[model samples]
Target: MTELGRFGVWVPHTEVTPAQAREIEELGYGALWLGASPGADLPGVAELLDATETLTVATSIVNVWATPAKQVAESFHRLESRYPGRFLLGIGAGHPEITSEYRKPYDVLVEYLDELDAAGVPRERRALAALGPRVLKLAAERTAGPLPYLVTPDHTREARPLIGPNALLAVEHKVVLDADPVRARQTARPRVEFYLDLTNYVTTLRRLGFADADLAKPGSDRLYDGLVAHGSAESVVKQLVRHIDAGADHVALQILDDDSLSTLRALAPLLREIP
Candidate 1:
């Protein structure tokens, strides 16, 4: 299995360019996680891979309902042949609202994995956007491990035991590099609001012990503080470290902002120094 260094950046493929991708590599981020849904062919993944050497590029997830497994596997093979160890395929069963045919997600994901296996996409070369015990176990048994999104260090602590000692637990965390508590929450709330509308996220948050009020629209401040690390770069690094201490093999940092490059560049120095 390819080691996805300790820290990575999660950004939308549409928002990042080849030049920017190269800069991110230079900035020392281990991997670049591209966010995509259905109909995403992942041409940008190839473009980013071509622009940099050594940095691993992974799809945060390719929605199973949006793209056929055969097509995704074909793309994975083509990219793997060209880039070799620099590409990791991250796939997931998206939300019920977004996927009209969303039902029996676990079974569907297993079928997709079967297709990838048939197409020769090695289990070690891929990861799953998994939450909950069943899916997390499946990720460990089938792929690299779960790449859980919008989770706290506590969740990481709980999840590590479920996936066991071998599987890679790459957790995604959102951060805001602002010192002011109000401004930080202001920046973080919008993203939380968006996820609050998604039932899957709400369910996961609830499982993490957040109250119903915390999962409410706009989300409670306590929930925001738990989910997003806001304040100085050092403080944010501390939050990332907590996840690592909780058994996370890698942490994908998602900056809440329109211009992610600036935030990434700003946080790079501090993140690179994380042991």
Candidate 2:
């Protein structure tokens, strides 16, 4: 129900600064999603919120396994009370490989949501990092909607109907700002390779029809191109727009370059006309 403007920035929590947060808002992006499952206490969140007047600051995901739902709920209320309607909570069931307590992801996520509900975290103020249909549907029913990561436009098309018409289908797409295909893919490979070993992502990619060859170590060129947008800023924007055309209510663009601020500035004007 919260209107995240057409485009937003997705950056690692460790990389964001107050000045960068302010500049991102001035550049006209709607929200800033802090990635890497930030702590339940949400250190530095208020500073970013304080630095901008209207920009929304969201967690790309707060790991339920690592952070208690009640603690997260309390933090949500604290931020909301200070900066009303400007913070969105995005949470997920993290990978089992890394989480010793990971078990029954769907059921765990359901229990987490129940805790949030008990703690009085408003449904509209939160979202899920949902990839599968079951969790996607739960996102639609219990929260704002899905903030899916590493998705193609085709995935967006399929996800829209599953979440139905009204829930927010905010998708995160990675972008590389190089024109040379070789260099772009080279820059994109490591990130792609990391996710390839993650069970949730691999399972979702398989469900999306990628072959084992495509999901192999280093990944296929087709897989890299499909997952990360590269080339000129204009060209990359075109690929990102496909997600919108496929029914995404919002697109959170994650820069794959070292100079993320520069990339965000370069893409700002083009992003304004995305919808």
The list of candidate 1 runs beyond 4 A from truth reads 38-40
The superposed Cα distance between candidate 2 and the true structure at residue 42, in angstroms, equals: 0.6
* Residue-pair clashes per candidate: 0, 0
TM-score of each: 0.97, 0.98
Candidate 2: where are CA atoms >4 Å away?
none
Question: In model 2, how large is the Cα lDDT of residue 101?
Answer: 74
By TM-score, the best candidate is: 2
TM-score of 1: 0.97
lDDT of 2 by residue, 134-240 (tens): 99999999999999999799899999999999999999999999999999999988777999899999999998889999999899988999999999999999999
Error of 1 at 79 (Å): 0.5
Clashing pairs in 2: none
Minimum summed lDDT over a 10-residue window in model 1 is located at 36-45
